[model samples]
Target: MMWKIQLFKLNFDHRERDAVLETVDSGWLTMGERILGFEAAFGDYLGHGARCTAVSNGTAALHMALLALDVGQGDEVIIPALTFVADANAVRMVGARPVLADCASRSDWNVSAESIARKITPRTKAVIVVHYAGFPCDMPAIAALCRERGLKLVEDVAHAPGASIAGQMCGTFGDVGCFSFFSNKNLSIGEGGMVVACDGNLSQRLRYLRSHGMTTLTLDRHKGRAATYDVAEPGLNYRMDEIRAAIGLVQLDKLPAGNLRRKELTERYRRNLAGSPLQMPFDNLSADVVSAYHILPVLLPQACDRMGVIEMLKTAGVQSSIHYLPFSGFTAYREYFTAQDAPLAEEICSRELTMPLYPTMSDREVDLVTGALLGAVA
Candidate 1:
């Protein structure tokens, strides 16, 4: 028998197709009712003083957030060394420099607040904290640090849509929270994103920035007597389409249930691997954090060679991957920072392996993956 499993997959059914068809039949295919509905629903879901604006994708959302903050040229934004390059790239897009920081060992691959505090300088304008793999970072400490130093706190919530720390949503605690609705994300729209901010002024500015700096969006333009518009500032076209927003609304409806299932599966993996040489990702109970359980990452012991185990798992028909390899290792950032300066991040990157944990995965698939992992280690 052949074994088949994917690292990531979208769970769309008849309901999604029906919603998309409904959107198509409505005749208005651009940003309109569907986008408004998604924004409202997402704001409610996050449970912060959150006001949401749907965008084209997560990267665009981040870019707009930085732009809205006036973070450009000669400013520095602090970010973790162990995250998707997009987090840092968003800073560069606005002509700002990205300062890399180290992650904490106890928090399981998340940036440390202490490290963030240490990296802050007079030129520091913002701190971008990523909730790595759905694990919420130390928000209280980070938020306090930002407040004290007067630095903008931006959250990269691409991996954690509905995640919370101490009963508060991840995105709400920061100055601006950005989410991804990529097909592989917890709340996917095939491809879309949103920004949540508590500030009304910032929200309005974001609206202007996402739609070509137009005074009104296309939806608003088609509805009223106004025939003329004005561009207040230079902006990018980052508006979300009605089709993607329709899919997003349906996916949002299913998120809570999907998150519960993911949690159950993660707990099962933890129990099954209790005594193994592999170290499961750590959870901080003190913070009362609950992950969306987007991915199950395990760290092999320092003695074990990570790439060798990945190849071994591949031979057994099981797929394994590394979450990141340190942003400094990438050529684009090498001039600003170096791998040698971030030994902890490099070490974590070398030993970390992410196993499959999608909602559609079965018990047998889990068993096969665990067995293969065990064999690789042995």
Candidate 2:
């Protein structure tokens, strides 16, 4: 089927094409100079002496973060009920139990420190916070809470790259900050991720865990920096190759402008959807935070039929999506992870609708989707 607007359109152009071709032509493909360059560029963007470890994907980043923190069996990691299932999966991959926490409120999709506190147990070893929809979570308070409780904090920053709170980047506030450069993220590199640490030692641990726990990297040996290598520990081969790293470098260069455009389009949608029955999450966010506006998800009225509304939009040549359904709603996770009463996340699941949003999207398209949503709800 065809649609007039897509839920997300790639911002690729000649630059992306040239990047891939150039990387292929270089003949140094496996996590070479390009990976180092991408990591360095990302660290510079998030300043404050941060370092990044490029990984295979966001889930790999999460897995490595957990392994670096030594979160294994007999430990519990708290994660947001509203985020993608990868968070819970990553926890499980490290042999840790995942405690699902509810969002702060109906208007706020981010999991709050209060909600997280409720899920804490004697075995809780870490807290993973998702900056849902590119909105910054109350990290300052969450970080403080984690510190007081002696729990490691990992920032699941897949939806947010340039997002900041009180003049600081979102990923820098936690023990391990994980980011995704998936096809639809604020910064697209098809399939890649980066992990940043609050300090140097943790960052080194992440890098070691990214490869097969080798003392010296293949790149180091290739550049004559090391004669031979030793297995420091058993690690996964979660290294990002040169092609994605090359593309990531280009995407990093374009992120600020792309985020700014998304902010503009998000405001345009808000203005156009004003007074509509649907409610936009983070509508009343504080002035100190800046959003990456990665997605345009809104909640429909309870009385509105979600599938019917989707069909209406489809007939009108508009594309729509759902951010996620609660993990407990799935059959695979039902027995492994017990379901708790998270009214906010459940309510969001029943009515969440994502409208078309992307950097290349125009104001007219925002108006078209908002108008279509109003009509569909009506």
- In terms of TM-score, which candidate is strongest? 2
Across residues 149-236, which tens digit of lDDT does each residue of candidate 1 receive?
A: 9999999999898889878999999989999998888998877899889999999899889988889766676898467789988888
Candidate 1 scores a C-alpha RMSD against the true structure in Å of 1.7
Q: What is the lDDT of candidate 1?
A: 0.86
Per-residue accuracy of model 2 over 67-134 as CA lDDT, tens digit each: 99999999999999999999999998888888888989988989999999999999999999999999
Q: Could you tell me how far off, in angstroms, the CA of residue 111 lies in candidate 2 after the best superposition?
A: 0.7
Angstrom error of the Cα, residue 248, model 2: value is 0.5
For each candidate, what TM-score against the reference? 0.96, 0.98
Candidate 1, position 211, lDDT: 88
lDDT values for all models? 0.86, 0.91
Best by lDDT: 2
